[model samples]
Target: MILKKHLKSIMSVTLAVGLVLSMAVAQPNLGMAASADDETYSGKTPKYVFMFIGDGMSYPQVSSAEMYLGELSMPGQITPEQLDFTKFPVHGALMTQDSTSFIPDSASTATSLASGKKTLSGVINMDETKSIAYTPITEALKEKGYKIGIVTSVPITHATPAAYYAKVANRNDAYGIGKQLAASGFDYFGGGDFDQKTGPKGADQHIYEIVEGAGYTIANTNEEILALNNKSGKVVAIDPDDYEAALDYEIDRADGELALSDYVAKGIEVLDNSKGFFMMVEGGKIDWANHANDAAASIHDTIAFDESVEVALDFYRAHPKETLIIVTADHECGGMTIGYSLTGYSTHFDKLQPVKMSYQEFDKLVKEYQAAMPSDPMLSDLADEIEDAYGLDINNLSDYQSSMLEDAFEKAMSGEKPSDDQEKVLYGSYSPLSVTLSHIVNSSAGLSFTSYSHTGTPVPVYAMGAGSELFDGFYDNTKVYGKLSVITKLDK
Candidate 1:
């Protein structure tokens, strides 16, 4: 009704008319096209889109990261080599149920992938009878002037980047989705940092002081996002430091930090401008590593979200007729299946690369060893630190994985109150020793899991630049908002 009560004043007058049509065009050096035949592709009108997703990705989490990157290829590569958004040209498969539920949460499948509208289940872009809110392909391309990024590895007000600029009816209400993502005067907002970043406890205003009093500009390390440029101003990096310090589990990041394709190449170097930007990224912890079934941290967060879908397919081969992209997901968590029953059909995905880290960093290494030995913490001294962070072979366990880790270490040292079969094998999760050591190293690399949550399975979309043949065949994820509202032309 009247654009869902002026969704925060239509993002403060569409970023004040996108800084006067981004200072009248002309500034697209988009970089990265040195040699895919020195690229150039032409098609127009899509005017730079994107819209990835991946929160709980499926199709067996993209064929289990293309069979664990084909067992980490390169020694005479016979296979395992399709990533960069699963080599899309066009592909389809959706049907992620939700209006109430059919296993779909990530705020009702990210508000039906940002306002294609199907609502319910802790709505965000409101609609399944909440008296109408919908209109969210980034606010219908912010009234056609565009420019509105929103990357995510998690927590840019969660629920899949707050369903492209909040309209909250309650997706965990992080202080009212951090005041609608600090008044969403949109331009950018990379992920993580705010599940409660100074809001839930003794709250006296501090979502970083209302996202820096709404003027924006808050990067977060990697030297303040590589000393941002591209006429920097309205930003929101948030590369962790609270909200469980996210942007993690790209096989547990280190060194400079900030990854999720460095927040989509710093959100395409500050939303590429010239009235054309509608980003959306996500890869949101591949649904918290399939809610802890953790197939090698959801295949290293789906190959670190295919390095931001190969940085938006190298800016759609340098604006292939004004970009389009797409990719997909928002459903199918641990129904993930890649054949296993102790290797009946064989699938040694390099034994999930010794699981380096993440069952949320072994659930913060079991609360840092129960706060350094809480009155003597020891589940076989943390099961020998999960067999040295998952190289497991726990002296080759498999008498049903050492009797389910000795009945999960005598029901986690008999703290009592946990028997529904020890709450479905360990406090229902938050790292029960990295989910019993990554499901016994993903059942010794043949892999398995049916549910810890989310699964009505379908997810897989792909697509490519301009009008991607309106997302070929099989539909329903609200027809990806009517084929991205006719490839973002925005007349609807």
Candidate 2:
């Protein structure tokens, strides 16, 4: 009996010793885990930060872009890299933009992301009481001795990009906003030219001159921009008006036409100081096309935006630890929703054709058809135009369908809703072709779009690099600004 007791005591001692040794080894790994929580920035200061905003992009937008590009591949669909902004190593969801109202405008949403605070609709970086509520991440970084740049496909003084550097009660205050942009002392500013002719009647006639006077070497062409040596603290602005005569998509092919990605790469090249730099690149036109209900055009622009992300991702591949890239949207426009199947339930979008014509092209065709016809042409005439543009044979469609389409077209021209049948055919009832195509794109490539207007839906945020850990779960849009500030340590 004594021997039995002795054996049990020996076993307990052995087990206790084993546990102590195991814990001792795990102590080092636990330190590594704790270090992950503490080590926000890598050893080197971030030499560069790129924030790409696809304005008005929600999950539906991303899905629509994917399905549009992939058609209806069943087994292995295309990946996000195939889209314009592609995919990120880390991603999270952002709250649906909400201001005083349920649906927030671009200005307020952008302001939230830029300043880490919610502001009123139509206001830039200002709160409901018309007070300048917050300082932007760019301003914070600039104060910390980092070069700053802001680029967008839309006008430079437009809502999203302007929120980063300008403070104003109204977004329409572009002329004044331009002056503030000039005075901000950012290293690079590129994109469409704002209609500075409208604000406050006889305001400053030389806002561009003001920008040039602020030690910025202003240029209109890509050649002049590329030729610039890093020594020149330059600000290059591309006037979209100068290229107005050219087709919108063709402008990028011009001698000086620069893609948004080109601006991003150039900004990085020029602002590669040892201290670091912060840049924002916006695919501004995706929202514009969606607002106009131009599915093809929106998909095309989404592809372009994805390409710009690829440029940043490539930069990260080379300097993974030193750069942080974040991609997100300000809000979603067009209330876009993806529908079920158009024909039968086959899980394939076979009826739709790849959209080749621009929204302008279809708009022009519809206008000419209306102008040339006598007073109130038959339903057949409108169907012919839609058939030619969409490559769908409406001849065999039900009389109800045909009538509905004609009525819808007439109402569209007159700026009114069409008859019931026409509304059903044009916008779809149980299954909308436009919305269905958007879903096919999403399901195929994990890209899908829902709705045609800015939805009260939340958008996704994708992040990568040293500070990406901050974008893990649901958070307010303002948190994005704070996260970037924390990761870059710009607040210091």
Q: lDDT of all predictions, in order shown?
A: 0.75, 0.67
**Weakest lDDT window of 10 consecutive positions for candidate 2:** 27-36
- The digit string of per-residue lDDT tens for model 2 on 318-427 reads 98988888899988777665554343323332333444455555556666766886576654565555565555455765555455445454555564433476454344
**lDDT of residue 103 for candidate 2:** 79
Counting clashing residue pairs in each candidate, in order, gives 3, 32
TM-score of each: 0.35, 0.77
Worst 10 residues of 1 by lDDT: 29-38
The residue-by-residue lDDT of candidate 1 on 1-492, one tens digit each, is 888769879887998899888988533211111111212223357778888888889788888888788778842353777887777878988888876767878887777767666767777877666666665678768777888888888777888888888887878777778778888788788868777666666556777778888888897877887777568878888875434646677877877666788778888888877877889888888888887788888888888888888878887887788788888888888786888787878777777776688777676777676666567554667657777678775667768877776666555544445547657645364434457667777877778886788888888898887878678777667667756765564544
Q: How accurate is candidate 1 locally (lDDT)?
A: 0.75
